[model samples]
Target: MSNVLRIALVDPSDGSREALKGKLLGMDTIWLEADCSRYEFFPDVIEQTAPDVGVITLDSNPEKAIELIQRLATSAPDTAILAASEQTDGQLILRTMRAGAREFLTLPLSSDDLDEALRRVSQMKFGSADAGGRSCEVYAIAGATGGVGSTSTAVNLGCVLASEPQNSVALLDLDLALGDADVFLDSIPDYTLADVVQNISRLDIQLLKRSLTKHSSGLYLLPRPVELQDTLSITDDSIRKVIGLLKASFTHLIIDLSKTYSSVDMAAIESATRVVLVTQLDLPCLRNVVRLMMGFEEIDDLHNKVEIVVNRAGLETGQISLKKAKETLGREIFALLPNDYRTMVEVRNNGVPLIVQAPKAAITQGIRELAEKLEKGSSPAAEAGEEPAKASESKWKKFWPGVKQ
Candidate 1:
């Protein structure tokens, strides 16, 4: 045993504390300090012993465990925290992560789990010192509603950026339940955002890269699990930590946000340097866009950072002309993507991004052009009469090859 990995166990039960201490004793390199249940002892223990790790046991109630974690983080940011809970759920896991746990383990603990946690903590300590000058940038994409093609746009945008030689990009799927960035890009990561949250405190660039699923295009995807039952809930702090880790490892970070607003979503949006709000040219879509835009405006800082993207821009609905639609909103359409159901359908069914499968199609061209404009920093103009940028579309062309419009 190295005696370098000092540890602290925080469990109300004396039996569990002794058991945990015994487990640590097996490792030659690990040193067990005080077994404390009272929060009052934490600062004193930490100040005197300076343990490398702190494990909080969540037996009957987790709220106290969470509070202890927050206090420890404030007093001892250097200490790695592992939360052990008898009750584990998406929401509880999220709560633990946000409260400052580096790792969350279910009860009936094993040596294997404890060993892994210790290894991760040790690696985090060393990784931070070796990370050097790496930094990340944030990009956000949101749809006006269901059909604005924000997912597709975000997928391709990340792919395009990652395709650049010497550049790394991470695509974060923030849609808790229905995200398809992983499916679209054909990425199956071993871990999801849930895993990231579960292990957020110890997350450094190296750990983050390990969690990412690499795509052929060189883009890395942090996906939401396919099973909604799987953990997806994340807290603001966990989201920040995940983003912080990505920012250290990648040059570009693309976030696909859920249409519904949540604190997690707000954190991602706030962290982003640019926000692409995707919408379409229909009254219903526009009305929804109006509400979203107004809602965003309520947050003064975010309004200026948002860019409007009009999907399926030129679709004529006889009810309202493109020019009229633009006039209704006060801002210009940042980009206009054409509608092509066949290509979209094919892309979705094939589990491939539209840009990769149909780069020459009109919709693809529009997307590519939009990407180019974003690269250049010029916002595309909305058709006349639509709102300038109400804050906020496209196609299934390939999937339904036999169907004709």
Candidate 2:
């Protein structure tokens, strides 16, 4: 099986088809390789896309759906079939399952329900398809204050990590209403977090990937809502669900969060394997970093998980020295990006990450070094405490909850 599980959608209902397509795109793991209006076309679409699973919508013609499921079972025995309909009848479900469908979902699928159904079907058929999947790392980037380069750090970090062919990265714009993380990479995603929130009921791994805008750097982007009002609809539960799903598929999951604190932001922090606290060398930014560190310290070892990243370092002489910042924040400086407004603006205007547009730039090199440290499982020498030597065991174990090889 490909690292990404390929899927095909067959639904005549325009609303359902479009909704399903949006949801599938939101997922980083499930690839929507085919979409046809009729099950009659499943054979042809399947032949072309060679999907591992067929999400066949069975609302209009249950009998035909059943027939197609049976036929596909016989002809394309390798392809798994999942049936969905608005029908709640136990009989309808039984009929579809009896016809060789691996799973069934009622129509207008909720994200939670779809995710559960797919998980069951995957476990049954692939039996730990993620056994060979990359060891996942999740990083959450937050700025001490707005315009502190957190989004840039998160975007470029994800880009460089994914620059390696073997790595898959998901960069999520969690700034919600005012998020412009996509602007940093110049990605205009068709579906954003707003779409995911609106269709949360029907979201699954495949649907989530469909929502993301894939960048030239091979990093997938889950941008925030376009309409500011839409942000109000997103709940902390949805944030948790989104991050949880991203962790399952991508090798690296980077989140760019809003500067201000919120319930959803806290949820992301709780789930993050590491939090990069991006700050500039100004006094106010340093003060906020100290305050943030205090907040992090309240939680046992959360302070350790947080690594200070000073952006635009050495841009201005006689600024708060790294030594003073560390003394104030009581944590080591994890990374220092050089000030390069020209290179940064150029790349942002071009809609590309620094690593892609100007690989040799100082800021780009800084981001790359951070990525390398992450890959090598090393912490900066100044990082607070001796326990970082054991960080991977404590951090990585949370992502993969339970699955035997």
lDDT of 1 by residue, 1-405 (tens): 011455778787878777776676545335455578765566687876677788888774577778888888888998888898768688989988999899998777887887667667776875643222223457799988886789988998887777677577889999988898878876667989898888775654456688889998888899976677654458887887677557645667899998886888898998887788888887777777666666665564566667878876666563456676667765566777877878888887787776579878898788777667766643333223333333221122112235342
Question: lDDT of all predictions, in order shown?
Answer: 0.73, 0.78
Best by TM-score, which number? 2
Q: Which portions of model 2 miss their true places by more than 4 Å?
A: 1-133, 378-405
- The per-residue C-alpha lDDT of model 2 at residue 386 equals 63
Instruction: Score residue 19 of candidate 1 by CA lDDT.
Output: 79
**Candidate 2 Cα lDDT to native:** 0.78
Clashes of each: 39, 24
lDDT of 2 by residue, 1-405 (tens): 125566888998889999998887665456566689977888888776667788899986888888999988888877889888888898888888889998887778888887766666566556784533333577889999998888888888988988888788998888987887788877778998878777765665667777788988888988998888888888898887677567756878898899877889988887777888888988888877755765664566576677788899987675787777677655568878888999988977887788768988888899988877766655654243465423333322322226121
**What C-alpha lDDT, on a 0 to 100 scale, does residue 216 get in candidate 2?**
82
User: How many clashing residue pairs are found in candidate 1?
Assistant: 39
